[model samples]
Target: MDSAVSDAAVGVPPLAEPDEAPQPWQTDRTRAPVATKIVVAGGFGVGKTTLVTAVSEITPLQTEALMTEASEGTDDLTDTPDKTTTTVAMDYGRITLDDDLVLYVFGTPGQQRFWFMWDDLVRGAIGAVVLADTRRLKDCFPALDYFESCGLPYIVAVNHFEGSEQFDPEDVREALSIPAHIPVMIMDARRRISAIETLLALVAHALEETPEE
Candidate 1:
């Protein structure tokens, strides 16, 4: 028998193995999508979790604690009376857009006590979304002031709740004292499409503010 044939018949290993087909989940390094970090910030009960939940393709990581008597006065439940939980830490999720861009969304804890985490959360973030509830406009001031003081590019996304009075984007901008250049959008955090649009706007704004390489 020929040496090569004999070796093959004896189960000798080949010098090189053929490349296997790429798996469905495998992504090409050269063509890999650009991934960016985005912080979703807002006051308590403003639907930060809902927005992240709606936009994320995968199940989001939530750090919620059941509302107890301990927070009765500190955390107001006026508008959201039926609410029974609060984000004690943070909410995290991811979404991909245009098939070439990926966004890692991080939702900050709305309580003042957990605000110490904001510094770490926004460290490498490209921008932020400040969700606002019209009924309690003051609730969002802390988040707005935070991002503003940090000089991070951000947008005002009013999470319009049903039965609440609707305001035009411009009206919201004026009410929030947002700069004219900063985008203010009326979005429904519960709707995936609306949340996606708000994220798209933030991405566009961040790109515009970013210096060209």
Candidate 2:
């Protein structure tokens, strides 16, 4: 007996054909948005999370852990004494620019022990924004070196904290020995407009450095 006939004879219904109909959730568009990945890196307590939160269109994903006595000497809180939580993993957020470009931002964990995660986080990233604090300028060196050694395009974003002495971008460049070609900007991480500008700067720099395929 034919399988279809046998099944019908057995009172079994034939299997339904796969759905060719468009899903209600699906939308048709002439062009898809361009998506890019970006990394926000800096030293411990340098406002990486704040920057991400400020610019993220959706609620940002955070992996912060409360500071404990165990981290006493290892974690320095001198400049950010009020900080009680530290990002143990990475911070994630998304933003859309120009209606056709989407940016997926990832903020690296600032603790030295979490440096291992940096390699994984930077995968597929177009470029990076290395956040710096004048109070602990040396802390950002690791991030800067990591990006440079890996040959990734990066720009420095000095996160100006309130009450901290502000320095000119050129002065910061000179102080950090950053190459003249690398753009550096002073921004407040807590402000949405400032963070957005920093992201725009990074996107522009990355585009300039990337070769057309």
Candidate 3:
């Protein structure tokens, strides 16, 4: 019998393996619930789907409806009011940090009309990422209000879209009425690394909020 065939017959070993070990790129890092749940909240046209999908491991789930004049009355047409459709359901995705730790992200509807689902979506989240578009910046208030009322820890990320003017982080914080304690960061969701950095800030905020050292 051939040497390779003999090894395979005994199931002892393979002729050779690749230099790198076979492993999932995204792994569960923490055992138990080390997998934290986080919500991605924002106003319509703020790029919520882009942020989550930018770093999501599995294919992201999105419920986007095409924009039409019917929604003109329902939605608005401003610099961003041109956004027609809205996410009727949440956009869902998951990422694994290691063998035991995983992070689940749910992108909430960006429209104030969907505020009804806020409580249901944020029930067990350790924190939230509120994406904002500076063009029609006021669009983010409803989401901020929802987070404030729910008492859930959260961070705001400026979804810097093309042609949008830059603003100081402090000004955004004040405009949004974000208390000094919360961390407000900036990110361009279309970029994965930027989204990851934004997430790191959120995790840091969550850790800081944990009781007594």
Q: lDDT for every model?
A: 0.86, 0.87, 0.77
- Candidate 3 has an lDDT of 0.77
Order of the predicted models by TM-score, top scorer first: 2, 1, 3
Candidate 3's residue-wise lDDT over 65-160, tens digit each?
887766766676566655656688798877655544667899998776788888898888999998988787788888888778877888999988
Q: Clashing residue pairs, candidate 1?
A: none
Q: Count clashing pairs, candidate 1.
A: 0
**Which stretches of model 2 miss by more than 4 angstroms?**
1-26
List residue ranges in candidate 3 displaced over 4 A. 1-33, 81-84
lDDT of 1 by residue, 160-201 (tens): 999899999998888889999899999899876678778889
Please, what is the TM-score per model? 0.85, 0.86, 0.81
| TM-score of candidate 3 against the unseen true structure | 0.81
Ranking by lDDT: 2, 1, 3
